[model samples]
Target: MKRKSWMLGVLFVLVILVSYMAKPEKTQNDLLLMNIEALAAGEDYVPIQCIGTGTVDCPLGGKTKFVMIGYSLE
Candidate 1:
């Protein structure tokens, strides 16, 4: 019983670790939405723009430009 419980605990931890590591990194849109949310909450926000070709301008303002690597807008 004790060994079974230990194995279960280890399995649970490994599962959690693998899931965390496999999680996708936040995208530009995600960060933009977060900034918008913060702005809605009366917090200061500096808008960012996309610098590469086929880039979409930030709705808020063009304060900073960023290139979304490995992402294409279709």
Candidate 2:
């Protein structure tokens, strides 16, 4: 009886671990939606945009243009 119970406990733990591992990862679109939600909730700052294509007028004067690496817009 004790051996059966130990086996059941191990099985339960294995099931839980398998479910966690099978969970889906968030896509970039999901992240973008989350960011939009946060911005709508006033939890995030507005992203700065460039004024022009040229370096002289780009970055909107005093605004900082951030280049995020390892991030995809897709």
Candidate 3:
């Protein structure tokens, strides 16, 4: 029983390490769901400081590692 518990603990640790150490997933293909209009408001230029990809859903699909900087009129 103790050995089995130890094995399970080790398995859990390995899974966690694999996930954390793995590189961030990406979408090489252009996601049609993403567009300028969806990102911006109007003629205003949105200051996007940083952005990252996610699960690739739609309409801001998936998770976004994004940060806003400032705004302006485009």
Candidate 4:
């Protein structure tokens, strides 16, 4: 009985961990919406000026490690 309970507890923990790990990461659209919301909230917004296949110098100034796959305006 005790061994069975122990195995069930382990299985429960594993399910929780797997669920957490399998959670979908935020997508570009999500990020864009967040940025829009931030802008509407009167927060500072630093738009991405440019993107490259790899790290490249931003036209604004410093270097950036962004590779923009797609973008949408409003």
Candidate 5:
């Protein structure tokens, strides 16, 4: 019974770890919204890649690692 309980506890921990690891990171749209908010607040915003063009080589590509900014605006 003690061994079974220990195994169950280990399994529970593994399940939790896997679920946490599989969670998706913040998306490009989320970053863009934050950037827009910053812009509205008159603060400098980090540039993001243009998602509309489906390319990371957009002008603002040099600013951030994610593609949150628009192509034309860059």
Candidate 6:
């Protein structure tokens, strides 16, 4: 029971953090979405982007290389 409660608390914290991180100020588009994913080592990964605010521009379907050596250091 104790472990279950602790797990629940942790999950609650995680959800709160995720929501807090995603929460952004109101902009012109009414909906702004941002997604970030870590690329796999030695593998090519593409970034999925959605633009809402006109202030910043993002490249659609952008690709980034993840080197194993560099990722381990960070």
TM per candidate = 0.38, 0.41, 0.32, 0.40, 0.42, 0.33
- What's the residue-level lDDT of 5 in candidate 4? 100
Query: What is the per-residue lDDT of model 1 for residues 1-74, given as tens digits with 9 covering 90 to 100?
Result: 99999999999999999999999997678889888887788624444445644445545445335543343343
Which regions of candidate 1 are displaced past 4 Å? 30-74
Ranking by TM-score: 5, 2, 4, 1, 6, 3
lDDT of each: 0.67, 0.64, 0.64, 0.72, 0.68, 0.54
lDDT of 1: 0.67
Per-residue lDDT of candidate 6, residues 1-74 (tens digit):
99999999999999999999998886754232222222224345444445444533344433333212223222
Report clashes for each candidate as comma-separated counts. 0, 0, 4, 0, 1, 0
RMSD, every candidate, angstroms: 16.9, 12.7, 19.9, 14.6, 15.8, 21.8
Q: What local lDDT does model 1 show for residue 27? A: 66
**After aligning candidate 5 to the native by TM-score, how far in Å is the CA of 64 from where it should be?**
42
Best candidate according to lDDT: 4
lDDT digits (tens) for residues 1-74 of candidate 4: 99999999999999999999999996678889988988888634445555544467665666676633344454
Candidate 5 C-alpha lDDT tens digits along 1-74: 99999999999999999999999996678889888988888635555445454434556443333355534432
What would the per-residue lDDT of candidate 2 be over residues 6-74, giving only the tens digit for each residue?
Answer: 999999999999999999996679889888987888523345455423324333354334422243343
How many clashes in candidate 3?
4
Provide the clash count, candidate 1.
Answer: 0
